[model samples]
Target: MPKKVDHDERRRHIAEAVLRVAGRDGLDGATLRDVAVEAGISLGSVQHYFRNKDEMLRYVVGYLGEQVTARIVAGMRDHAAPGPVRSFLLSMAAEMLPLDDRRRAERRAGQAFTARAVDVPELGEALRYGDRWLHGRVAELIGRGGRDGELRPELDAEREAVVLLAMIEGLATDILLGMRDPGEATETVRYHLDRLTPQGS
Candidate 1:
């Protein structure tokens, strides 16, 4: 009998190789051949999973999002505590920033997609979808703060969420471009979060 192939595991292996290539050589260097070599698999095998470069590129964005969501979930689990609004926002923003090597690679991949999204329809749609999803999630978390009475009831959660998301993305860009350090980016977000809660709360 033939060995059963784990399709999910195979995809993740190829996807991670894509990220590893992007980290080392930018997105331009993450061709199928490059990923195959990086993944220690055959070129035909990589092509078997991804029909073409466009399909692979689109898959990568969703993969990166999953990685980020996993990171945020793990962070939430480790810091399991009183679910305060300000801290929640901070933690979310922190997850979005390029604080570590893995995150830095993610940021690079994201930036590469963003640049290409201008010319690639699929990649552009992926980015727009991601933006909407991020905004919706952040807004939901912020709204929870309102219900918890941690943040002001009058606060516009959507507006606040959008601003924070922009700030978080900006910080990530700054970090990637070498204009700021991870600590500085995180502290800046924390400082902003501090004003969101009451003095004694």
Candidate 2:
């Protein structure tokens, strides 16, 4: 009898391998052959899962977005009250940083796809829509914070949402470049978060 293969598990393994190769070796090195080797599967098996490079790339893009969303939702669920608006904001923002190996690899893969998406319209659409969803979540959090008196009353939720997202992306970019420490960036973001709230309010 032959060993039964878990197709979904194999696909996930290939996706993870894609991340690793893209992270350590750059996107150009993450060829189908390389991913197949990294995933410990035959080239035919990989082809069986992904019809072509474009399909595989699309899947990887979705995988990274799903990973980030799942992390943010988990963090929100774990917090008893989601704490202050600043706390929720910080927690959600930290999901983008390369604070752990898994996140680091994801960040790398995300950056690679972002650059490639310039010429790939579908990938560009996915990124744009994903970013919009993220911004909506952040804006909602900001609105809640203002109502609870945990944030500055004069702060514009939509504008602050964009700013927060930019800051988080900048921090992640620096981390990916190895020019900034994740810990330091996290602290810096916290400082900015603090400034958004009044001492007594």
Candidate 3:
């Protein structure tokens, strides 16, 4: 009898291999053949799941996004005891930073995809969707903070959300380039959050 294969699991395995290759050598280095080698699978096996590099890349990017979202959700649950909205936002920001090896690899892969997305309309659209979703969520949180009196009464949630997102992205890039310390990057986030929600109105 032939063994049964879990198609979803196999695809996830391949996605992990893609991440490892892309993370180490950038998107250019993550050829299907190289990914198969990294995954310990046959080239045919990878092709069975991904018709081409673009298809595989799109899947991997979406997979990485799901992983990050899950981590943020888990962090939110852990901090459910919430005192201030700033703490909640800080927790969410922490998940976005590459503070450890696994996250560092993930960030590298994501950055690689982002660069490639410039020429790939599908990839660009997918990334735009993610950015809009994140922006909306962050803006909502900021708006909530304002209403709850946690943030400045005059704060413009929509504008502040964009600033915060840009700050986090800039900090992540610096951390990845070794130009900034992770701890200090986090402290920088906290500092900004403090300014947004000052000790007293």
Candidate 4:
């Protein structure tokens, strides 16, 4: 009997290989041949999963977005208590920054895909979808924090959510640009979180 192939798993593997090739070479360099090489498979195998380069790029783009969303959902699972909410949020934000080589490579690949999406506006919609979902979650968290007395009484949850998202994205960009180290950038957010917490917290 022949071994059963997991087509979905194989597709995911190809998508990840695309990111690896994109990281090592620029996004444009992640050709089917390069991806096959990175994936340790034949070009025919990758082609079986992705019809062409555009389809591969789109797959990788959605894959990265799904990965980030999964992380966020996992991080939010256990951090429900008011006292731990802010710290938990910080940790979640940290996941977005590149603190290690693997994550840095992934981050670079994601940025490249996102940037390329500008020319293809439909591709950019995936990113915007993620942003909108994340922004809503953050705003809800901020509102919860206020009711719990973790945040200032007067802070506007929607406005602060936007600001926090901007800061987190900016800090992540700085890390990509080598303008800030991950540790310091993380601590900087911690400092701000401390200020946001009530005097006793």
Candidate 5:
């Protein structure tokens, strides 16, 4: 009998290698040779997972988006009963920042790829679609909160959601650049949301 391949685990390891290469060497530094060496896999294996550099880059960005969205969804579920939605939102949003050493590495990798993707039209378009999808998902969640009286009725969910998302992304970048701490960034968002809450809601 042949050894059973753990395909999912293998894919995750490859994905992580992609992020690691980006973090350590910058986006352009993550060539096939580098990723294969870092991942401890054959170059052919790396190619098996990703057809090209652009494909790998796109994968990393999409994975990051999924991770951040999942964290937000979990936070919202955890804090659903709370009187105000701000805390939940902050908790969810904080997942995007370099709150710890591990997340810092991920943030670095993501920023590197984001910068490069701008010059690659196809990669940029894929990133744009994923970003738009995430924005819509978050906005819908906020709108749900408002309808349930957990958020201020006067708040504009679409615009507010975009602003909050942008703030989180910006703060994450700032944190990576040593301009601020993750906690301070979260506090800033909390302060903004507090002022937006309805009088009794």
Candidate 6:
């Protein structure tokens, strides 16, 4: 009998290759043939999973979002007990930043996709879905903090969540462009979180 192939695993492997190629080169450089080379597979194999480059690009964007979500979930698991809302918010922000090689690669690929989305409505819709999901999640967290009295009573959770997301994205861009240090960006996130919560709480 022939060995059973894990098609999902193969797709994930190809997506990872796309990320590496896009990070090292640019989005334009991550063509089907180039991704096949990077993935150590035949062009036919990549085409077997994705009909074309656009399809593969869309899959990779979803893959990257999943990776980031997994990171945040893993971070939450590290905390033995329920922590402060600010701590959770900070953790989420940290996961989004390019503080290490893996995250840096992710950031690079993400930036490339963001630019490409400007010309591709399908890609733009996919990217927008991820953004909306994140915004809603952050707003939910902020609302919980407000209810718990951890955050200022006068704050609007939804609006603040938008601001926080914008700040994190701006910081990530700066870090990616070498305009900001990782440590400093992290401190900036923490400082912002501190300002949201009451001193004693």
TM-score of each: 0.91, 0.93, 0.94, 0.93, 0.86, 0.94
Candidates' lDDT values, in order?
0.85, 0.86, 0.88, 0.83, 0.78, 0.89
Ranking by lDDT: 6, 3, 2, 1, 4, 5
Q: Model 3, residue 69: displacement in angstroms?
A: 1.1
Query: Which of candidates 5 and 6 is the stronger one according to TM-score?
Result: 6
RMSD for all candidates, in order, please.
2.1, 1.6, 1.7, 1.6, 2.3, 1.8
lDDT of 6: 0.89
- 10 residues in a row with least lDDT, candidate 4: 79-88
For candidate 6, write residues 1-201 as lDDT tens digits.
999999999999999999999888989899999999999999999999999989999999999989998877676566434457788888888889999988888999999999999998888998899899888877877887787787987789999999999999999999988899999999999989889987785
> Mind giving the per-residue lDDT tens digits that candidate 1 earns over 96-160?
89899888888888888899889998899988987887788778777777777787667799999
> What TM-score quantifies how close candidate 4 is to the native fold?
0.93
* Regions of model 3 farther than 4 Å from truth: 76-83
Q: Whole-model lDDT, candidate 1? A: 0.85
Can you write out model 3's per-residue Cα lDDT over 97-156, one digit (the tens) per residue? 888888888989989999999999899888888888888978877887887788987899
Error of 5 at 143 (Å): 2.3
Expressed as tens digits, the lDDT of each residue in 1-201 for candidate 5 is 999988777767887888877777788778988988999999998888889988877777777666666776777677656345566676766777788866777888877867887787766776788788768867876787788776777678899889988988889988877798877887888887777677764
Clashing pairs in 5: none
Off by over 4 Å in 1: 73-82
CA displacement after TM-score superposition, residue 30 of candidate 3 (Å): 0.4
Q: Against the true structure, candidate 5 has what lDDT?
A: 0.78
Query: Model 2, 21-43: lDDT tens per residue?
Result: 99887788888899999989899
- Count of residue pairs whose backbone atoms collide, per candidate: 0, 0, 0, 0, 0, 0
Top-lDDT structure, candidate number: 6
